[model samples]
Target: MALPLSVLLVSLLLLIAVPDIYATFHHGVHHAVGSRAHHRIVLPKHHRPKFKPGPWKQAHATFYEGGPGSFGGACGYDDVVREGYGLDSTAAVSNVLFNNGQACGACYEIKCINSPQFCKRGQQSLFVTATNQCPPNYYQSSDNGGWCNEPREHFDLAEPAFLKIAEYRGGIVPVQYRRVPCKKQGGIRFTITGNPYFNQVAVWNVGGAGDVVSLQVKGNKKLKWTPMKRSWGQKWETNAMLVGESLTFRVRASDGRYSTSWHIAPKNWQFGQTFEGKNFK
Candidate 1:
């Protein structure tokens, strides 16, 4: 009654192979389902936040045309250069929002809500970057108590951007604004100016919550990083003589996140030289 050896061997192989086959099939199914679920959970590109959202505020906005004197304001950016940030028809806010240049480079979404003449069709919203400060002296001198003197959250928009939301005759319109992340193209750029002994750097083309609040610099010769003062607008300056061929910078945004750019300045770096570095976005 003994079975054939060949039959016994074949039976054993089937027992082993069946389980292996089932396991392989089950694993494939699980992997496919997991991948599809992950894709579904991802957010859309446009809806993504440029930076973490802050509190919303109601305010008023006025527009002005860019002319000869419209170039530089309290933020210290030279509109004539056109290479620096905020030279375009952007928006300037009062000291309450400017925070003495701390708000420089901050981005906001402003929507025209009131003023029937401007919002007759529907509310129009525009995303603007803060590049300048609305001076308080101008407000004090105006008869109507200019927007600069307003309680807080007042915006002086560039004429072109403002017209997108309101008519030219509207002059001033009620608006609601909220802080949003800045979406920038490519990496951040560092422009070095002044002599090596006293270098001033302007950081621009920042993405992902683009405004810089604090900046620090260090060279190969220095054992520690030196904090740079906000010279004006987006420029940070250090009086220390950077003798090394390369330099590094650590930048902190308004959201309290830090991004470092290492060895951005090359050897033989001269005044008015610009180097592009990694971005936050």
Candidate 2:
């Protein structure tokens, strides 16, 4: 039997309301059908985030376009980007020491910078002997990735080597040398502690790098480091040299096999003292 007038009126209102509510549903179903027929895009499981083109020519870019999100690459997500800073597996300069003690991903993400992706080529990272602290003149080692000098480090602080005025008139008398008060270039000085040859006060490395050691007097022009006296490590003591501000500096001790810090500044800057047994390393 045909519906009554009132029933028919209600049915018409329901039909009108259904179209508006199901419009999006119908559209989505048709779109899916068309996409499948044309093989334009796969289903949800296979769908990928639309990737932008790479080779981003922007200033200080972070993420590159058209790169995979979950692939292990050397250049893109290495320790530099994920841990420190630098290009993707791009050959990192061994001399510059970057800050790594901070939090990771706390800064920019990989692909954000035009870093290497380690896809075509593998990764290259340093194996610093210790943490990330670097030395003077030299920053990071080119190979091992720790404290290193500019070239093949040729330095040492041996006796008979002159400081302010080389020639000493009196016996192993008391002398004075200033402390490296600056932050960038620090210095160390000390009195001749051991006379290896009985003629020259000699200091050698039994570990770390080979005979790559050099010494110098500390001053503003000499080297710079933490200016605070407490940071100097030890209270710089004087053996023959009496009074304050005396130090003996040694650095760049590398033997090619086990290269490491020749000597670390003691608790306080002191002369006539020697640091041994893998202290620097």
Candidate 3:
């Protein structure tokens, strides 16, 4: 049978267009579209590590009364503001989000939802660092004073951070939140402490993944790196006498990224002094 002229032309058009359509769809699926941006995040050149942003999930938020001297908690940070985290941009996440202190320094974006009366619509979401932990109250039920109880995700935001998303009078408001990479200003800061026989270091001002998973230290006289154990939270310690020797540090974050800071601490470094070193992207 002889095909009509119009039918042959239609068949030819389909062959040409179908492949292009399939390619476009395939690219979209592989690239993965990012979430709608409430506000543009400007990352620094050294802080531009690509991270897979998690999906927004439901949670609850409340505020606690705290100030500069009182902001630090389980993360080993003595003063969050002095440590580079803004007073209004810090929060204490519950156990689920705190990840047993591993969540320290991790950033998150949160916004109030389902509470039009208190939620300020069209405003940028609240971006905060997990500086502390909202401990679970075994003495109270999850619905009562135990809002941070197990299985319940909650955020005890700093008063200022809370007000950015909801009115203080709201006490607690429904919110949607997701993990975000921290954008830090400078290199990682290491606060050294302890006696000559023991060395305890607190890691802070971290960027990128924002949480340290493992740390190793080497002295100027030593060829092999000495692994440091996590003393508590972001604090890692080693018994090796690093005194009188210039110190180098290797830090690894949760994202599997590594940064080496060579001779960050001087040979004459003293306890209670802090030094800056290379940061991760």
Indicate which candidate wins on lDDT: 3
Question: Is 1 or 3 the stronger prediction by TM-score?
Answer: 3
Error of 3 at 7 (Å): 72
Candidate 2, 127-215: lDDT as tens digits: 11111112334355533333134432211111112111122231121222211111111122222332322212222212222122232
Task: Give the Å error, residue 165, model 1.
Answer: 0.3
Q: What is the C-alpha lDDT of each candidate?
A: 0.75, 0.26, 0.87
- Clash pairs for candidate 3: none
Worst 10 residues of 2 by lDDT: 101-110
Q: How well does candidate 3 match the true structure in TM-score terms?
A: 0.80
Q: Which pairs in model 1 have colliding backbones?
A: 50-181, 51-181
Please report the TM-score between candidate 1 and the true structure: 0.75
**What TM-score would every model get versus the actual structure?**
0.75, 0.18, 0.80
Global CA lDDT of candidate 1, please? 0.75
The best-first sequence of candidates by TM-score reads 3, 1, 2
Worst 10 residues of 3 by lDDT: 34-43
Per-residue error for 101 in candidate 3, Å, reads 1.1
Count clashing residue pairs per candidate: 2, 48, 0
